[model samples]
Target: MHQLTDCQLIQSPDDQAAYTSAINENPANAGTTGRTRRKRSLFNYSKLWANGRTLKIAFLDNPPAAHKQKIIAAASQWLPYINLKFVFVDDEGDIRIATGNNDNSSMLGTDALLIHPDHPTMNLGVPPDHADFDVIVIHEFGHALGAMHEHQHPQANIPWDKPKVYAFYQNREMNPLSKTQVDRNLFATFDTLSAVHTAYDRKSVMHHPVPNSLTLGDWEVPINRRISKKDKRLMRLLYPK
Candidate 1:
């Protein structure tokens, strides 16, 4: 992965524009591709030493208590695999809460953070009331627990059709990327199959949405949802009991 300094150099306005254009032309190329591969350490569970101690987790209060329960349940299911002892705390001292902010969620020192009470997304007026809550909570918690995007795996060899991916992200107005973005994304070392990865899973809960047209080239899947076997193995390795 490009060092933070290198990343800064490419952050120049002209470079940014060029990078944006490149990404707009091919979203799949938003990560490392060739000759940028870096060696990574094997994921070793021994590295994460919870010491048989139950991890204390706390969620700042949010609306629709049911959604909180769902988030907790999802996280719980994945906890054992990581050999972690976890329990949710009820006091604010345990986890701070902000009504409409999630940016600081990771600062609590806890393993995960759920949605804020008044997030715009929750206010969208959907029937289920918590339509995207589960996905968001699970995905973010995956990060708090040290997961990274699967599409960005160092060993990945995505056949990104740059033109198609760039067009899709451009239409969506998501962060525009460049070859540097791609190289930084691909070259960074990972501990293991990130908890974020779904095994070649297009429907994996962690997979980000990419346009169908981008799947035509060397890209293998259209979407991803469930965590992959490789991901599970990596988790076990990272936090093994």
Candidate 2:
């Protein structure tokens, strides 16, 4: 995580305009587009109980103890709806510290997060403001439970102003224009409205806030705070009867 100053946080209207422009200017994603033919729901407890296997999760000792607690609490909210037990361990067993390298990818046998102790945001002194530890934990755990990125929803027709988003990320140094910055299969199709969705929610614990510069163009962001209807529906479906 990068430490962003208050000034950096304050994205100006002009900046927003420029970001939208960049998004629109960027070339359309070339790979397969549209919804995935095989739709997978978020969490359906009943079905999971019948067919799903219990998954063991252990967090590497990178994040602070407080941060770990927050992650657990957030997970508890959804655990009752799903049919798996989440276990946390102090030692590096199934999951290990995130080295930020591609080689150590399978630290967690199923799904897990590796926090780099040296990362500016993960380390002390950095404000724990933008990235909600609990939400991030739950979102990552969702992946461990076989959920994919909601933004990659196949049916999603994001009205991204490519140039604008690119410019916004560039200014913030969060740009994913190049293959290194963005995954090649990012635009590949998957059904976003499936039961596993955290709702069409921008504020859900599963969602990341769009840069202010790119908020205007066809992006539906939430004003208040709460999970989206879609999130609830998906959770029920994934863990349902």
lDDT of each: 0.42, 0.39
TM-score of each prediction: 0.54, 0.54
Q: Candidate 1, residues 1-241: lDDT per residue as tens digits? A: 1111111111123434433433443332234344666642123111122334465555444536665566566556667567667676544322232324322123211212222323221111111244454444555445444555555555444666766655543454334456555444433434332423334434444445454466654345543335556656766765667
Candidate 1 weakest ten by summed lDDT:
1-10
lDDT top scorer: 1
Question: What's the true lDDT of residue 7 in model 2?
Answer: 9
Question: What lDDT does model 1 reach?
Answer: 0.42
